[model samples]
Each structure stands twice: as C-alpha cells, then as structure tokens.
Target: MTNKVIQRLGLLLAAGTGLWGQGSMTVTDAIRKAWVDQAGLKAGQAMVDSRKAEAEGYRDLRLPTLTLQAQGVRTNEPMMAFGIKLNQARIGMADFNPLVLNHPDAIGAYGGSAVLQQPLYTGGRITAARKAGDFMAQAEAASQERRKQETALAVVQAYFGAEVAEQALKWVGDTETWVKGMEDFVGARVNQGLMLESELQRLKAFHAQVDAQKAEVVMQIRSARSGLGLLLGQGPVDGALATPLEPGTPAPAAAPARRPDLVAAELQAKAAGEGAKAAKGNNLPEVGLELGAGTLHHSWSQKGDWTWAGVGVKWKVFSAPDLAKARAAKAQAQAAKDMQIFKEQQAEHETRVAREAVTAAEARYAAAKDALAAAEESRRLREARHKEGLAPLIEVLDAEAAVQGARTLILQSLYELRVSRASLDLATGTPIEGVQP
Candidate 1:
C-alpha cells in the first residue's frame, strides 16, 4: 500500500482506539480545569484570603477596647495596708495614727474592675496602620492575580506543546511507514534484477534512520503529555487534538494598563510608604480615654464600689531606637519605590518583545505553509517521474524527505505562533478569558 493509504489506515485505527474520539480535550477546557484544580493557584487564593482577614482585624483598631480584671493582696507594709483600706472604703480616722502607720497589721483585700479604653488621637499612627493594612491587602490581591495569569500562561504553553509533539509524532510515524514501503519496493526490484543490491541497502539504512526519528518523536509526545497532565493536576494523559492549532488574534495597539506584577509592586510600595508614616508617628504623642467601674472588699462585712473616668497621654520624648526605626522605614519605602519603577520598565520591555515575537511568528508560519505546499508538489512530481523511469528512486526519496521536513516546519511554526500569542497576552497582563487562543 502507498504511504498515504497506510497513514490513513493508521489514523482509522487510532480513531477506533478512541484517541481522536469523544475523549479528546480542548485547550479551553484544560485551562478551565487547571484554574479550578491547580494546587498553586489554590494556595495563592488562600493567601489573599488570609491577608484580607488580617486587614479586617487591623481596621477594628478604630473601636473601643474593654477589659475585666481581678486582684488580691496582703501585706504588713503601711502603704499597702492603707491603700487596701482606701480601695475598700474601710479606712477609719484612727488608722492614721503614727503608731498604726509605723507598724501596720497584715491586711487582705480583693478587687475587680471593668475598664474601657477609647483612643482619642494617635498622631495619625492608627490611620496609617489602617491604610497600610488596606495597601497590603491590595498587594496580596494583585499577587493572586499574578499567580492566575502565570497559571494561564503555563497552561497555554503546555497545551500547545502537547499538540505540537502529537503532530510531530504523527508525521514521523507517517514518514516511517513511507520509508518502510520504499525499502520493500527497492528490495523487490533488487531481487528482480531491476535495482542494485546497494540501492536496497541504502533504502534499508534510511528506513532505520526514520525508525529512530519516530522513536524520538514518540518520546517527545509522551513527555509533552505528561507535562501537560501535571499542569492540569492530572498525573498523565493521552488524547488527540480537540482544539485547532492556529495563530490567535493580534494584541491591541496599547498595552494593558495593569499587569498583575506591576500592580502588586505598586501596592507594596504604597504599603511601605504607609509603614514609614506610621513609624514616624511613633515619636508623636498618643491620647486616649479610660473609663472603669470596680468593686473592692477588705472582708465579707466590708465592701465598696467606685467609678472613674480619665484621659491618658503617652509621648516618647526621646528615643534613639524610635528615630532609627523611622529612618529605616523611610529607606525601605525608597527601596520599594525604586523597585516599582524597575518593574514598570521591565514590563514595558517584555510587552514590546512579545509583540515583536508575535509578528515574527506570523511571518514564519506563512512562509512555512508556502514551503509545505511547494514540498508536497515536488514530492508528487518526483514520484511520478520515478514511476515513468524519468527520475531516479534516490531523487524520489529526497523529495519525500523534503516534504516531511517542510511539514515538520509548518507544524512547529503553527504552534510557535500560538505560543507567541500567549506570550503577548501574558506580557500585557490580559486576562485569561481575553486570550483569543
């Protein structure tokens, strides 16, 4: 049978075995599955959730705090004994005698108090802290988005890689079958005295080479499938193509405004700036109001109740550590700003490169398609000439090889074009759903 017939038969057998049947997976479906099942993406989302919870906790600082406490003491010290009596409202005029004060008896007392504290002012420290929490939460959200885009890019590459490898394997298998048929034809001609034994030997050697190439292509397909499976959180998978391999739509003229990583960097820089502000606020005074209601009893027979309200102020008049910390925070903020600028520049460069790659890939794919058509025409003409005794068998074999090589190039270019489009989407931070491929 002719090589084309054999290849068709092989495809029929493959289909019967379900390789290209209903079990096929589309690239879009694979990406959707990975988005739902990928462990790395899940972990990133969890981190965002954790940061959001932390930010919510920080925002609670604007509310009042309440505390309850109980205490007991017994001492012969004059100060402790007098204070205990005063708290229990059990102090007597005679208890002020110098003799009792000099040698006071041991006294036991128990007290409990419920206190509420409300911050009145914190030199903007509280506000800065809340803002920092918000910024950090934004940063985490951006990071999660970055992770999602990365995962989508990874899926696109792997899906295309698997498709490329599958096509290579199929092409190589077809070429191998064609070489085997040539070897048998040459062997028969040699036996019939129409071809030399050396020609048949050469054909056999070429057949062996094709076989080895087929083996390599098989391995490539296997490896590609394994990698794609891992990315999809499946151990391994094998199937025929469900999505057509083609170059996607070109990117828009203007790049996307918010690449995930750049957004994350900007938010992180803002968070750092807020932290610096909070650090500086450490040197300023803080004011708060404290309200308490309590009961104290020196004995079962004696008890007293009291309520107090007061304003409190705390000022760090001078502290070397606080100054150093403020300086360090400012330096960190500066570093973050510099990093953000660098990231922005890098992103712009990457977007430009990816756009160029897409253009180049489109050109290459068009060229490869033309070359494949030309090679097939050459192969058909050479085969016809050989059948008519106008061309040598070697010339026919060479033309066939050229056709196979051109087909391989076409396959590669097609997949490369797809990959370049994916890269462009990634560079621009286009959402996965926005990716045409």
Candidate 2:
C-alpha cells in the first residue's frame, strides 16, 4: 500500500488504545493527558514537593537536639591519672602522697554521656527561617500551577494546528477530484475536435499543481501530529483528533484575576522579606539550656555516675560579615518586591492585548464565513455555465480555485479564533479543561 494508506492505518490502530480508545481524542482529553505525562510539568511538581519537604525540615528547628558520646582512654601522665581516678571515684589516701602524685601509675577510664540541648531563645532567627521556608514552598506550588496552564496552552495550539492541516488537506483532495474529472472531459473533447489539445494540456498542468499542494499539506499534517505527540510526552502519534476546526465563540470577559505566576512572585517577595529578617536575627544573642548525664568507670568494680544541667548564652558582638549579609538580604528583599509590582503591571497589559486579539479573531472568522458562501455560489454558477457551453473551461477552473482558497481562509480564521480564545483564557488565569491553576 502507499504511504498515505499506511499512515491512515497507523492512525486507526493508535485510536484503539488508551485515551484514543474512545474514538478520536478531543482537545480536553489531550490537555489532561499532557498534564499527566509531560516531563516539564512533572519536573515542576517535583520542585514543589522538594520545597515542601525543605519547609518541613525548617519547621523542625524548634525541637531539642540529643547527642550521645562514648570514650575510653588510658594515660600514665600524673595529672590525667589523678583526674581519671577522681572521676571514677577511686581516689585513695595514698594518692595524696607527693611521691605517688608526682609519679602515678597508668590509669584507664571508660566514659559515656547523653546530652540534650533545647533552644531557649534564638533571637527570632528560627521563626523567620521557618516562615521563609513556608513562603518558598507556597511560591513553588504557585509556580507549578502556572506551568500547568502554560502546558495546557501549548496542547491547545498543537492540537488545533493538526486539525487545520487536516482540514486543508481535505479541501485539496476535493479540488484534485474536480480537476481529474475536467482532465478526462477535456481529453474526450480534444479527441472529438470539440476542444483544443492545448486545453487538455492546461487542465493536466493544473492537476499536477493540485497534487503538489496535497503532498505539501500531508507533510504539514504529519509534522503537526509529531509536535502534538512531543507535547503529550509521547513519541510521534498518528491518531485522529476528534476536535473540529470550527470558529470558537467568545465568552463574556471577566476582570483579569491574579495569575499563578503573579501569585508566585508575591509569595517569593514575602519569602525574601522573611529571609532578610532571618539574616538580621543572626546579629542578636542566642540562649539555650543543656542537660547531660555521664558515667565514668576505672574498673568494673569501681564506677562513678553524675548528672548536670546548665543554661548558656551566645552573642556575636561585632561581626562585619553578618552585618553585610543582613544589609544585602534586605536589599534583595526590596528588589523582589519591586519586581513583583512590575510583573503585575505587565500582566495587566497582557490581558488587555489578549482580549483585543480574541475580538479581532472573531471578526475575521465571521468575514471568512461570508466570503466562503459567496465563493461557493460563484463556483456553482461557473460550473453550470461551463456545462451549458456558455462559459470557458478556464473560468470553471478559476471559480473552483477561488472556492478552495475561500475555504482555506475560513479554516485559517477559525483556527485563529480558537487559539485567540484559548489565549484570552490563559491571560485571564482561567482554568483550562477544568484544571485550576
């Protein structure tokens, strides 16, 4: 079989599995499929998860820290030997002798300790850090939502682009059939001396042109399908799309809502502010409480155990680096806030532009429909006249070409209208395929 037939068979087979199993896949189905399988969106979700995990870690900073240590040592040094004997509670009256104290025998001691340290105060550093982490996680989650919307927008474009190519190809096929019939009619007329040989040759040349156009359109259709597959996180797909290339109706425009990216920026700004506070907190004093219990044994028969509790304060009196870091963090926070404001303004502009584009697309689609109607009527009249021998074959051919051109234009305008409507939804932060951003 020819490549075209093989391609068609491949499409039919693909339609028998997965989402396509229900029949030709619709635009909504394609968007949902891409949401599940697209690698970029998966990566975005992973980043959000990672941020949440980090935030959890930051929140756990308030808990106490426990450390356990074990040590065994033998020393012949007089001072160490005396200390070891004292710690093991094995000191003897003989150890008081100057001769023994100056020249002590080797002593061995084993010790173990468990220490717990709880923060009493951290100058708000821990709180700020936790808040910053939470904000970062929220920001990442919002960013992921924006990524989903962006992915949905891409699926819409690729899906409809394939439909446009297929529609054009269908019209080209009709034109080809018409030209073939004309070629046969002209050839028979030439044989009967009713039509010139040059007329038949002219008809044959137009037929070649139509065939060439069909081949180009077929390539376009193949390319669009491959691109759609890539967006869906699959390799080349050859399934028929159920979504038709019809003009999209414009929805009532609502005031633009805050897009996910804008929300992300706002959250990121808050996170930066918290980060600055955390950095500033580094300059303040810290306080903590520690509780420890330990045991020391010189021999199995002679052992000493003790417990202790204490509180400590730590202050960095003058650290130039800490001061600089705090200043830098504050500056960065301000910059982030400023950037968020700029993005909000830019988003407003984008929404306005997108709405205008939708309106223009709708108008163009309506005009194309009217033009197609006129072209179809003209084609019918020209063909009728040619059949009655009142019009030239060339006028019939031209009329057919005009009708095909008009049909192509209508398809193009309808595709644009669909895309523009989708773009408007994207700009307004509207949900796509019922997926909330």
Candidate 3:
C-alpha cells in the first residue's frame, strides 16, 4: 500500500503543471517567477520606455537642429524672372531670351537649403522640460519597481496558500483513513463480543466526521490549485499542483534596504518633485537661434550665382497673467510633497505590522506544537488504559479525537507562521531572492 501511494504521488507530480523537483515549490521561487512573467510587469516596462524617450527629447534642448528643404520648377516662364545683364542683376520681373538664358541653363526655382536652429532659451520651458523629464523617468522607474515588488508578494501569498491547502488535504486523508481503521477495529472487536456495539457505532460516527472533513479539504485544494496556477502563469485547466506537501524550509531574511517597493516609493517622490519644478519653470522665457542658406540659379545649367544666408533669435520675456500658472504649479508640487510624506508613513506602518505578525505566528506555532505532543501522549495513555479495562471506550475515543484535532491545529499554525514570515519580508522592504520555478 505504501509503494502504491508513492507511485500515485509520482503520477500526480508528473501530471501537475506547477510542481518543482520532488517537493512543493518554494514560495520565493514562485514569487520571483511571477514578477518577471506577469503581463502587468511588461506593461509597466513599456511606460519606462516612454519615459526614456521623453528624457531623450529633453536632451535635444541643448543641441542644434538642421532642416533640409528642396524645390523644383519647370515653368513656361520664370515665376520671378530676372533679366541678367552682362554685369548686373534685376530684382523685378524681366523676360530674357530663352535661348540666351538657356545657354546659361537658368534654373529659376531649383534650390535646397539646410536650415539650422538652436534653442538658446525658453522662458523657463526648456529648463522646466528638462527637469520634468528627469522626474518622469524617476517616476516610471519607481512604478516599475513597485510593480515587480507587488507581483513578487502576490505570488508568494498564492503559492504558500496553495501549499497550505495541499497539506490540509493530506492531513485530512490520513486522519480519515485512520478513523476508518478505528471503526473497523471496533466492529471486529464487537463481533467477537470483546467490545460493545455502542463503541463500534461511536467509532463509525468519528469516521463519518473525518470523511466530511476530508471532502472539505479536497474542495479547498481545488480552489487553491486555481490560485496557484494563476500565480505561476498557468491556466486553471492545467493539472492541479501535486507536489509533496512537505514542511517548508527556512529562508534567510534579505537586507531591508534592498526592498523594491520602498525604493520605488522613494523614486516616485523624487519624480513628483521634479514634475513640480518643471511646472514652475514653465513661466521662464525661452530663447532660440535660427540659421538658413539658399541658392538660386538663373538657368537650368546653374550658371547664375545667387546665394543667401541669415540668422535670427527669439525670446518669451514676459506674460502679464503668468502668476496664476506659477501658483498652480506650486500647489501641485506641494501636493506631491504631501503624498511623499504619507507614503513614508505607510511604509513604516507596514513594517511594524509585518514584525508583529511574525512574532505572533512564531508564538502560536510553538504553542500548537506543544499541544499536539501532549494530546498525542494523552491519546496513547487512554488507548492503553482502555485495553486494560481501566478506561471507558468513550474516554479513549475522546482522547483520540483530541489528538487528531491537535494535529490539524498544528498544521494550520505552521502554515500561518510561514505565510506570516513571507508577509514580513515584503512589509519590511526585504524581498526573498529566488530563481524562477
């Protein structure tokens, strides 16, 4: 029977979608994998690209720009014909002999110019834009970090939750079998007139209760399987997770400072501040420089020597009603600063809560372990006493029930402790590092 059970376990593991190695997959591994695989993380990454482009656009502020322009014309007559004398040129319209102009191959409208422009200043728009880019990048980066961190935490919770359910199922299965065995044993004894029929009936009642509990655990496992699938990026229709429901091994705590969520929040605040600065800078004047070159030929042959060059500048020195705009920007900055303050407070609160949960779970686990041991001892004593005719069958049954109950409680408490530990790592800004499952 033991070998058959092992074979069944193997078959289940082979069919399961989320199993890792020979044991239940680690929570940390599951979380890190989900973080990298979740669609939302990829979407957040796209935002980062946009922010980078915005920053690159800002870098263009200090660089020169060049534009190329070209035009072609084969007119019946020059739109602005210039009658070129041997040594002179005229601005007004004049018809020259087509043959003579043709000899020089006049190209009245066939010229291209390369124009260059430089932003010398923008009433503070350029500076503001640069600052805004910086902040925007920071914000997006922070947002990405936040997304990754949240994904990790979510995966951890879901993975361990499924694990707990699996463990529960195993516990129920074992207890149910044991209860059935007890019933059969009592029936055999009663058939031989060694135990009362009432004792057999009581054992049967206990078996029924165990069966009910087992059914509930099975349903719980199904729900847990769905959650685990989602976290591992597997579809719910995949074979349910079938890894061994072993107790989780301890994982080392990470450095609190390395917490991604905390870093992300910090970056967000910085980004917000930058945005506010950019808004304020919008009121400043912007300056720019422009340059262009053009050449016109009198004939298609390009004998006409005509050239032009120019440079210009601009500035937005003042706006009479700009106070409202500046004030609005100031208000926005203040709001962001306030948000930063709130975020910091929230981080501290989460950290404290995580610490308390870990402490509580640890204490509860210790207590449950002791209770389970004591109950098992009591049951053993009661069973011996009943066989010796010193205890009633009801007392022995009661003691056995207590032992089973303690086992269930211990399982629950252990799961709770591990879950709490995972939460603490997340809350304290110390994520468990792990490879993909």
Candidate 4:
C-alpha cells in the first residue's frame, strides 16, 4: 500500500479507538482528554490537596490539646530524694536531718501526668498562621487552574498542528496525482511529435519535488501526532480535522485579577503578609490555661494523686534571633507584594499581545482563503485552455503549483488562527470549554 493509504488507515484506527473522530478531534474533546490524562495537571491538583491539608492542620491549633507524659528516675541527691518523698507523701523526720539527707540512699520515683492546655491568647499568632495557611491553599488552587489553562492551550496547538500537517500532505498528494497525469499526457504528445521530450522531463522533475514535499509533510504529521499524544498521555495518534477553522470575535480585555497566575501571585503575597504578622507575634507575650492530674510513687509502696490548674505566661522580652526573623519576614512580604504587582502588569501585557496575534492570524487566514479560491479558478481555466491546445503545458503546470501553494498557505494560516485564539482564551482566563471557535 502507498504511504498515503497507510496514513489514512492509521487515522481510521485512531478514530475507532476514540482518540479522534472522522472529522478529527474537536478542541473541546482534546481539552477534556488532556485534563483527565495529563500528569502535570494531576500533580497540580495533588499540590492543591496538600495545601488544603496543611491549612486544616493549622486551623486545628485553635482547639485545646491533651497530652499524657510519664517519667521514672532513681537519685540519691538530698534535694531530689526529699522532693520525691514529698511528692509521694512519704516524707519523714529523717529527710530533714542534714547528714541523713546529704547521704540518703537512692530511691526510685515514678510519675505519670495528663495535662490539657488551652490557648487563651497567642498574640494573634494562631490566627495569623491560619490566615497564611488559607491563603497558601488559595494560591495552590489558583496555580492548579492556571495549569489546566496551559494544558488546554498546548492541546490546541498540537491538535491544530496535526490537522494542518494532514491537510498539507493531502495537498501534496493531489498535486502529485495531477502532475502524474500531465506527465502521461505530455509523453503521448512527444511520441506523436506534438510535444518536446523536455516537457516530460520538466513534469518528471516537478513530480519529484512534490514527492519530496510529501515526505517532509509526512514527517511533520508524525511529529505533530506525537506531540498531541504526549499531551493526552497516550502513544502517537493520527487523525483528521473534525472542525473547520472558524475565527470568532476576540475576547474583551479582562482584569489581571481574573488571570489564574495573577490571582495566585496575589494570594502568595497575602500569605506572606500573614507570615509577617505571625513572626511579629513572637515579640508579644503568650498566655494559656494548663490543667494537670497525676500520681507520684516512691518505691511503688507510697503514692498520692494531685490535681492542679494554673494560667501560664510566656514572654520573649529580648531575642535577637526572633527580631531578625520578624524583620526578614517583613522584607519577604514586601518582595511578594512587588512580585504580585509585576505579575499583574505582565498578565495585562500578555493578554494584549495575544489579542493582537489573534487579530493578525484571522486576517491572514481570510486572505489565504480568498487566494486559494482565486488560484483554484485560475488552475481550472489554465487546464481547460491546455486541453484546447490554446495554452502551453508549462502554464498549466505553473497554475497547478500556484494552487498547491495557496492551499499550503490556507492550512498554515488556519493553524495559526486557531492557535492564536486558544492563546487569547488563556490570556483572558477563559475556561477551555468557554472558548468559542
């Protein structure tokens, strides 16, 4: 079978496997498949989940914590020995004697306690931490959205690229067929002494050129298929264009805040600001309520249970390290804010550029369509004139070449137009499904 026939069979198989349809894969379907198959998108979603889990952990800090602890020790030191006895309610007059206390025999002490601590005040540290966690989660969520958009755009480019390559290959094949017919016609004329042998040779050379062009286009089609397959997390696939290029109106300019990347950047800055607040909390006093119930034993023979409750205050009056950390956090927050502003500006610029590209591509595609029509009409006239012996074979060949060139331009311009539209949708923060044409 010819390579063209084999390629067609491959496309049919691809369609049967649901990678694409008879018309080729639609942009919507491509985007949907990519969302489900793309490993990068899955990883992005996992990161969002991780951030959500971290946020939940931070939020849990507001609840009281209960802990159980146990310790055992054997000591002969006077102070420790006496304290153990006292805790066990086993103290005696001998423990008060200086010599007896100083040279007391070692005694084993064991203690188990359960304590509950409730934070009454943390100088807004917990609140700030929770806010930071929430902001971080939001940032991750935004980042995941951006990743989806990017994946959709990539699918658009690859899908259309394959379509254009397929069309170009078809054009080359048709040109080759036409040239072959011309060669046969000219060879008969030469045999009849009505055409020169040089005419047949020229036709043969044109056929060779068309064959070379066809080979290159075949490779391009394979490469395009490979790219699309990679984006869909599959092996190389072959398909045809399911939908024609229909350039739609450009999307209106959207605020930078609507862009997922810009939103993520803004959230990151907010998280950084919360981090600064949490760091400053280190300089303030922390207060909490602590309650404990425990039993102490001396030699396992004497034991007593006791309950105690108290309010605790912790203050870091002067810590150089904490001060430096707070300052660093403030600087980081400032930097994050600056980055957010820059991202907003960049988003706007990108959107504007994408809009311009779409406009230009649409215009080029329109012009190419018109040129193809004119070229096709001219080729028909030239071929008719050649049949009537009123035009030279060379003129007919030139018209055929013009027709093929116009077809090539049409395919390329259509590809560019579709890709530019996808880019504009991405820059405008429009969902893939919502992107028309």
Candidate 5:
C-alpha cells in the first residue's frame, strides 16, 4: 500500500483530539488523559491523608497527654470512687460533703481535676502501635503507586486498540475500492466478448466478500472506540468528537524497572516486613501516659470537682505460643517478598518476549507487503497480456485474487505487530521516565 492510503486512514481522526495530534502523545499524557479520573484520584489522596492521620495519632503514644477537668453532676448514689492515703495509711472513706453531693446517698463529689500522665514504659505496645500506623501509611503510598500503574496499563491497551481499529477500517475501505475496480474491469471484458459470464459471476462473489470484510472492520472500529472511552473514565462508545488514532513507534525502553506496580510491590513487601517486626515487638514492654480531667457528683445536693492524672507501664507477662504467631507473620512477610520478586521476573520476561514478538511480527508484515507488491505487479502484467489476447481471462482473475489475499495478509500482520508492541509496553510497566509525576 502507498502512504496515501495510510494518510486517508488518519484523516478521519479528529484533528482537535489527542488521538490525532501531529505527534502521538507522550506516555505521560496518555496515562493522565485516559486513566486516573479526577474524582478517583481525589479519593485516593483522601485515603493517604487518613493514613497520615492514623500515623500521627499513633505518634501521640510517645507523648504525655494533658487535659483540664470540669464537671456538673447529680447522683442518687456513688458514681465513682478513689481511695485516699491518710497519715501514710490507705483509708476507704466516702467524702459525703454537700459541696460534692448531687443527691442524698450520693458519695460526696468535690473539685475538678487537671489530669496529666506520661508513659513510663509499655512492653513494646506503644512502639508496635506506632509502627503499625507507619506501616499502614507506607502501604497507602504503595497502593497509590499501584493505581498509577494499573491506569497506565489500561490506557496503553485502549489507546492502541482504537488506533488499530482505525487502521483496519481504512485498509478495508481501500481494499473494497480496489475490488470494485476489478469487478468493473472484468465486466467490461465480458461485454466486449473478451471474458466469460462465469468470470463476471466470480467478480460478484468477490464483491460480496469485500462487503463482509467491510462489516467486520466497522464492528472492530466501534469496539475500539468504546474501549478508548472506557479508559478515559467515560461511557463506552462515547469517545469525544476530537478523538482520533495516530501511528507512531513505541519506545521500548520507555518501560523501565520502575514501573509503578513493580515499585508498589516492592514497597508493599517492605511494609509487610515492617508489620512482621511490629508483630514480634508486641512481646516487649509498652509504655502509656494517661491524662484526664473530669468531676464526680458525690452528693444529692452538692456539686463535685474534677481531677485526674496518671501514668502506666505494661509488660506482657505471658501468652499462649506468641512465638508461633510472630513466626507466622514473618513467614507471611517472606511470602510477600517472594511474590514481589516473582512479579518483577514475570514483567521482565514478558517484556523480552514482547520485544521478540514485535520483531517477528514486523518481519512478517514486511514480507507480506513485499508479497502484495509482487502480486499487484503480476496482476498488472496478466491484465496487459489478456488485453493483447496472449493470456486467458482466468489467469488475470487468479492474479487479482493473489493481490487481494496478499493485501489482507499484509494488513493483518501489521495489526498483529502493533498489538504485540502494545502488550510489550504493558508488560514492562512502562519506563519510569515515561510515568506521570
């Protein structure tokens, strides 16, 4: 085929659309334009913020809590109690002073308390809590990266799908035109008594075949348009008026080791290890600081005061086979690590295979093109010979069929190469430099 035919295929693309730009969009633009809707991205960001909040809350475990106390209470009976040390002796006594009483029979309640307590030590409980929060935050980050990778892959497939379908449609259109021309030429020969009626009938059958091919191409084009729309976070079959397909070379190295999904997997594996560490650390000491301000109404007729402050430490005295549980967590982490490695290996292998496939497909397409060119030249010679009365009509007809068949094979081969290149791009997790920021 000539460049003119390829140019016609592109002319149908909306010039205003990303699909028909003078140059194909960079991978970064395609990813953003096709995937990662604003709403979904915002939601992802909110999740990250939530993770940060959780981390911050856990960080508070290492700091003392301070609070002021104030309370208004009325109680028919004692609502709360605290023992007092009188003269170095612990005395169990209810202060029934009216100033603290909310009602009769209510333990006397008094002044408000300003409570403050700092963690003395926790058997690694606080540390584990904090670490867990940190791990969660890290996981959230990884999840975001994974989202990016997923979107990129989706865009790659969809964008190229549209491009391929457009190409197919154009090729089919051109072939149909050529088939009609052949039919006309054969019919003219028959009218001139130079071709048989059966030959004319054969041309009609060929025309019918072309019609069927056209239908298939139309369907394929519609499907591709839908796929592209879906990637852009829009309804299928709703591609913008400006949407168009453009042809270009895919940069093989654009996919790098830093594919977002791969990076995310690595981070997730690390987070899993952190979780395992935190789980094991649960066996150690945990320190806590508690501070509260609240008042108790001790009397039926009197108001109560608020006062509070405390600090505490906890040591996990004993547990049932915690070692086994911790070991399980470690094992889980190891499994995650293995999975991450496997994913990387899989991506690399697929990329290499895709590269080879693309090369092979290209070779096939080139061979097919050459075959079609040869077939066309042969058909031309036969037609000339038949006009000169030196060749039978059958020979010309056969030559035409060869040309058409070769054209179809050439188109199919080119399509396969494009599809394989797309697959390779998806496999490699696209180059880090090609990724959107």
Candidate 6:
C-alpha cells in the first residue's frame, strides 16, 4: 500500500510536467515557424512573386525587340521567279527579256532576315502600362503581408488553445485528487460508525464523477494539441508545447495604424487609375523606329544582302472600339476608387471593435481573479468545517464545485485576454503581440 501511494503521487507529478515536458516554444517562435511552414502563406508568396514578374515584363516593353527570320522558296511563275532572282542579285540582262520573264525556269532562293523594332513614342501608353503593373505588384505584396498577419493570428489561437486545454487538465487532476482524499476519509468514518454509510457512498460517487471529468479534460488536451499541430503545417504533434496558456502584458494603448489590406486596396485603386490612363493612351499616335538587314542566296558563294532603317508613325484617328474602351476604363477606375474607400472604412470599424474586445477581456480577467480567490477561501472553510462535523458532506462537495468553477472562469478569462490582445494587434496591422520578423 505504501509503494502504491508513492507511485500514484509520482504519476501525478509526471502528468503535471508531461504537459510541457517534450519541448518549449514561445508564442513568437510558433508564429515564426508557422509563417515559414503554412501552405496558405506559401501560396500567397507565390502570388506576390508572379505579380512582380509580370511587372518586370511590363517594364521591359520599353526595350527594343529583335527578330530573326529564315525561309527557302522555289517558283516557276514569271513575277515570283523574276523577283527572287532580282533579290538574290542573280538577274542578268537576258532575265529582263519579256520572253524569258514570261517563261522563267524554276529557281530556289534561301533568305534570312534580322529586324529590330524600337518604340520611339506611344503617347503615354507604355508608361501608364508600366506604372499600372508596378502598382498592382505593390498591391499584391501588401496583400501577402496581410495574409502573413492573418496566419500569425491563427497560430496564436492554436498555440494558446493547446495551452489552455493542458492547464485545465492540470486543474481537473487536482480536483480528482481532492475528491479521492475525501472518499478515503468518509470511508474511514463509516467504518467507525461515526458517519452514515450513505455519506461514504456519496463521496465515492463524487470521486467517480471527478474521474470522468478528468478523462474529458484529457481528451480536450489531445484535441487542442492536434489542432495546434495542424495549424503549424505539421500533422498531429506528439511533442508538448512549451508556451503556457496565461495572460501576458497588455498592449500599449494607441490609435490603429494602416493595415496591410487597406494599403493593398489603395494601391489597387491607383493601379486601376493607371490602367485607365493606359487605355486612353491607346487612342493616341504611336511612333517607332525599325531597322532591317537581310540576304538572299541562290548559292552560298553568291549572295545578295540589304539593310534598311526607317521611322513610322500611326494614329488611330477615330475608332469606335477604342473610344468605348477608354470610357469603360474610366468607369473601372471610378469603381476601384470607391472600393478603396469602403475598405478603409471597414478596417477602421474592425480596429475599433478589437479595441473594445481587449477592454472587455481585461475586465473579465480581473473579475475572475477575485472570484477565484473567494471560492478557494470558501472551499477551505467548508472542508475545515466538515472535518469537525459542523458542515454536511453536500456543502463540502458544493464548495469544491464552486472553486472549480471559479478556476475555470479564471482560465477562460486569461485565454480571452490573450486572444483579444492578438486580435487588436491584427486589426491595427501590428505584428502579432509585437513579435517582429
């Protein structure tokens, strides 16, 4: 019996430590790990990269384009044969004869050409296109940052959720231990004929109830840990989480900063405006320079070569389709500006609500602390009174229940406070709990 009691005590000790024995991680560490591992964040980063590449492509439109062409052709038709011979510089005085020109023999020529085209001006079309692309890329980058912040917020919830479950399990274990001691005491009283047998039976029933509650808490702990693991981009984690579920320092009171999503919306609006400008630019004149060099050879040893350079200008003058496009672009720009305004307002509302939530959580935590203290003292008094036969067994059990309730409330309030702080950080575009990258 002595060995059994010692072993049970040791097991309880191990359970307490085992909740966090495998590894330790701070909230900051978990967020950083999630940022690197989370699939959603990775996808968002890919989108940002794609947008940046597109922007580079748009910017490269200002660079000249060079093209190379090669072809071989044979023809017996008079005009085509004569043209090929002229281009190949194989035409002779006899080739100019009307009779020979009308009935030319089949001839084959191999031709290769290199052409370079440089845009001299296109009104503001290229400039606006490049600017629009740059702005859109910036918007995507901002949106990605917002995604990271959201992922961090999720990590906070999962990390602390596991901690809360583990902490609650420890408390439930304490309740179980207390109920067991009561059962033993009551059993001894009934054996001595001092307390009714029914009283001992009641204590045994309450001990069993506590044991059931402990089992439920254990299941909760496992579930919470599994959820945390999934959020970390790993499957179920067997290692104990290092961060404890507890209240921390409150966030400094301040006005909310511009959130990343809001910035993205603003940038998107700017991009749309630039797109409108680019669309209108399409109606203006375009000027360019073209350079060409080519060679035609009937035989490699005897080839003809030519080079030419020229400037060209083209004007749409009046195209109904181009006019409609410009009008549609203008409308789209207006719509984007409106959407940006709406997003700013929405962001402001979210920040205000998050601040209120933090305030409410703080108040709840303070009240819970007071209730926990009173409930603990009340339980102590009831237990002491019951020992002296001043209080009934039921009253002692009720007191234990009250203490348990108060402790649970305290834990819940602490969890809420921590979550509210993180929520506020997210709303204000702050790093989660001020954790820096």
lDDT of 4 by residue, 133-231 (tens): 999999999888888888887777776666666656676677777887888888998999987798788888777777766766666666666777778
Give the RMSD in angstroms, all C-alphas superposed, for model 4. 5.2
Q: Write candidate 3's Cα lDDT for 1-437 as tens digits.
A: 12233233333322222322224345555665566666777778899999989888996777888898776554433333343332124342323556545454443355556778887655556666676677678767766776676676565555555555566567667766766766776777789898888888777776676665656556555665665566556654223334333345666644555455455555555655655566555666555667666555445554334444444444335665565666776777677677777877887898798789878887887897899899889988987887676888788767766765666556556656765766676666565434322
TM-score rank order: 6, 2, 4, 1, 3, 5
**What are the TM-scores, per candidate, against the unseen true structure?**
0.86, 0.88, 0.75, 0.86, 0.72, 0.89
Candidate 1 segments exceeding 4 Å error: 1-22, 72-78, 92-107, 248-257, 299-301, 387-394, 433-437
- Over all chains combined, what TM-score does candidate 4 have? 0.86
Model 2 misplaced regions, further than 4 Å: 1-22, 75-82, 93-107, 247-257, 385-394, 433-437
Per-residue lDDT value at 332 in model 6 = 95
Q: What is the lDDT of candidate 3?
A: 0.61
lDDT score, candidate 5? 0.61
- The 10 consecutive residues of candidate 6 with the worst lDDT sum are 12-21
Winning candidate number (TM-score): 6
| Residue 102, candidate 3: C-alpha displacement in angstroms | 28
RMSD (Å) of each candidate, 1 decimal = 5.4, 5.2, 7.3, 5.2, 6.9, 5.7
Model 1 over residues 75-116: C-alpha lDDT tens digits?
899888888788889889999999998899998888899999
The count of residue-pair clashes in candidate 6 stands at 1
lDDT of 5 at 6: 32
Residue 276 error for model 3, in Å? 3.4
